[model samples]
Target: MNTRLLAVAALSALLLGGCTDTSPGGQAVRARHEHFEELGKAMKEIDGQLKADTPTSATVRVAADKIAELAPRVKTWFPAGSGPQDGKRTDAKAEVWTRNADFGTAATRLEAAAVALKAAVEGGDAAMVRAAVKNVGAACKNCHDAFKTD
Candidate 1:
């Protein structure tokens, strides 16, 4: 029974090991996507708290910093050999990948805006925070408008 169990375990390991693609590039994209989605959700929560007139600077800063950190990873989704644009994402647009340069520029803008937001959060000034949030939101929206389906 022990030998049988050991054989089964070995087979399971072999079968399941490469079954999951934990490739560096693939892993990076998945991680970035997860981080960005989390950033968005966190930001929405922070925005909701802010709208409630609650002191959520710490929360907002956390979300903002997450976004800032994840922003530069946006390009990871577009791998060199990733092929001709996957529009099936529903959230993705054909043009974003088809017009690669434009997409990269937009991604860079997002990273830059996120960096600014990070600075604002670090500044810990309410007015500056608001302005930075606005700027970061604008940058995201601008890219989404052109690249995202909805």
Candidate 2:
């Protein structure tokens, strides 16, 4: 009876382990998608403020800070097996993994742009903030053009 119970327990563990999504490709694809969604939301909020005749410094600061926080984390979401070739639904291009150094540089540039935008918002100068926002947008575009699929 005890032998039969042990065998059942072992079988259950093996079955459950197989059911888990332990693949790095699956996990990275999901994480990178969610991260991009969050970054988009923050960027949209900042853009809306920039479009206003009189943008609120406080709101812009908050949104810009969020982008700064998220930007540095962008590289971490694209580990090995996270590309389109992994059979996962990822917009990340194969070049992201192939040319990793370039991708890392792009991510670093984005973080710097975000940080600059945050500083501009704190300075409470709308024109400077606007310029900084444009820089941020350009940094994002550069990365997306190289590493992401439309």
Candidate 3:
């Protein structure tokens, strides 16, 4: 009876573990999706502030800082086997994996732009902030155009 109980318990553990989609591809898909969503929210908040006639510098700085923090982690979010072909609903194109070096460069550009935006915001100059925001947007567009799908 004791041996049977132990065998049943071990089998149950294995089955439960297998049921969870903890595979690298599954984890990467979920993480990258979440990261992009966060980035989108931050960008939207910053854009809203920028569009205001009398934008709040503090709010803009906060949103820009969030983007700066997330930028570097963007590279890590797209691990191997996380593309659309992995039977996932990701918008990431297969070219992201094939042209990984270019993807890394694009991520670096976004990081640099995000850092610049944060610094511009700190300077309390509206014109500088606007220019930095445009740079950041361009960096994002460059990557999305190459590696992402609509």
Model 2 TM-score, all chains together: 0.82
Give the per-residue lDDT of model 1 (tens digit) for 1-150: 699999998777657643343655444445545666886896786577568764236777778778877788787775642322421222456676688799899989988888887787787776777777777788888888987766
Error of 2 at 111 (Å): 0.9
Residue pairs with backbone atoms closer than 3 Å in model 1 (clashes): none
Best by lDDT: 3
List lDDT for all candidates, in order.
0.69, 0.83, 0.84
Candidate 2 global lDDT: 0.83
Q: List, residue by residue over 18-81, the lDDT tens digit for candidate 3.
A: 2454789877787777788888898888889888843446778788889999999999998777
* lDDT measured at residue 93 in model 1 versus the true structure, 0 to 100: 65
- Record all residue pairs in model 3 with backbone atoms less than 3 Å apart, i.e. clashing: none
In model 3, state the lDDT of residue 128: 89
Q: Which 10 residues in a row give candidate 1 its minimum summed lDDT? A: 81-90
Worst 10 residues of 2 by lDDT: 13-22
Candidate 1 TM-score over all chains jointly: 0.68
